[model samples]
Target: MAADRLALALAVTIRHDGNGGVADDLTAPEGLTDWVRELAEPLRDALDAEDFTADTAALDAVRELRAAVRALFARAVRPGPPSSADAHRLLPEDQAMARLNAAAARAPGAPRLEWPDGGAPVVRAARPPGFTDADRLVAALARDAIGFLAGPERERLRACPAPRCVRYFVKDHPRQEWCKPSCGNRARVARHHRRHRTES
Candidate 1:
């Protein structure tokens, strides 16, 4: 679910340009940071992570990651697992994992043992030695994307079938097709019109 959430967040960055065109938020660092931060907030809240500011370098990393996340979701909605070539084209597994690990290495925390009242000691994440807040945010997203692709939830991801919508979403139930009800209605109407045309 978290992965789907992440996928949805990334997908939203690709906006419809009103003339059946698409716009990428990654074109500018400012826009990228805004979009990533908008989504990252939920992600941070989920982890109870401290807020992170996206720098130029962090923007570049997240934009690259966005491509990988997009490609994975696109592949998931297709008939089978993406071919090795296709998968590698967007984000090579080794490369993505390595980047993720690199970002994580810079995460602002070290594992420390914490003792709670009447509770056994538990290891908690503390600020790491030299990582910035942005590193942690980007790392968290990378980890989510990897887990989602590898986990069973990938099976439930779907792309909207609306005429001009390019969003991918998790299917809430069986018999679901389009990403939202409006898309489903549009699909139904299109199918109905096709049947009528054939009959006529």
Candidate 2:
């Protein structure tokens, strides 16, 4: 996945549970393991092994990073309302930035060049020695979040306004409004109901 997409993926891990409540995908070690495995392609550079597992500490660390990322995401969507799940509970902007930077610093990486036969040269982030898997994971996520926030995609970020939804998405087109088609439909239905209630 690309940097912007990876950051968005992490942000969307906290979303509606489809039953009028928010759900956290990274609430458990198993969920964290599954999430990492699912995004293994984009996270390949950060992971030291294929069979990575999460412990309590790793889960807690990643959750803290996610909160920071979400807070920054909310800030990125400036003037717009944040996701309803934790809108009132988001960390202060400065604190969030500090936490994210600290996480990224835990696993500092340098760029490395690679060239293959008859192929163009490519640059990849080379992980330094002695960092734990958790450090790498959190750092990778923080780095991606930083990249997304500083990149062009930050302008397109928006929080879904549909009822019971709490997701942030990058608008794909000029006319796009909600995070997904379902959210759009739900928002429209909610509007209709509100209109009906007022008329009654």
Candidate 3:
């Protein structure tokens, strides 16, 4: 259970990194993910007992899987779908899912997928000023809709009610109404105007 939670958090953070760049703490560093490296060693040991190899080919396979998982996570926080560039970046792996599935078939007691694949949907980042990053990110977001997430902190997933600020938030009470305190006061003033106007 701890492993599963860790994986979930790692996946979410990795997804936010979007090909890696140092930014807010919510993101990770560029290059091979440390969490992945940490998890890989243990995973390898466990799988090895089940006949998984430590051969060069196996190492490559694990890296590929790590990449796939990382890519899968990024779409969740990306503002838009992946662009053409993103598609091209992930093309090889896109072509390799069937193969990954085949390998998984060989493993004993496969992990439950929890979500329906519904097949990887085609996204176009090539029409009129296309960018693969957007398309890829969007596609990833769709996957997130069904993908495993650390049980959503419902209290932290509120949508701001301010007309000018439809932005999302990790914390906002329904009664809080607006995204910001100013917006909340604005609502109050609006209500006051409506009430006084009607009284007049």
Candidate 1's residue-wise lDDT over 167-188, tens digit each?
A: 6677778988766787677677
TM-score of 1: 0.69
Candidates' C-alpha lDDT: 0.63, 0.89, 0.36
TM-score, every prediction: 0.69, 0.94, 0.31
Query: How would the candidate models be sorted by lDDT, starting from the highest?
Result: 2, 1, 3
lDDT tens readout by residue for model 2, 24-116: 999999999998888887888888536889999999999999999999998988899999889999999999999999998889898899899
Q: Model 3, residue 107: displacement in angstroms?
A: 1.3
lDDT of 1 at 66: 71
Q: lDDT tens digits, residues 8-51, model 3? A: 33333322122323222222232223433344433332222233
The root-mean-square deviation over C-alpha atoms between each candidate and the true structure, in angstroms, is 4.9, 1.7, 15.8
- Clash counts per candidate, in order, are 5, 0, 20
What TM-score should be assigned to candidate 3? 0.31
Give, for candidate 3, the lowest lDDT window spanning 10 residues: 22-31
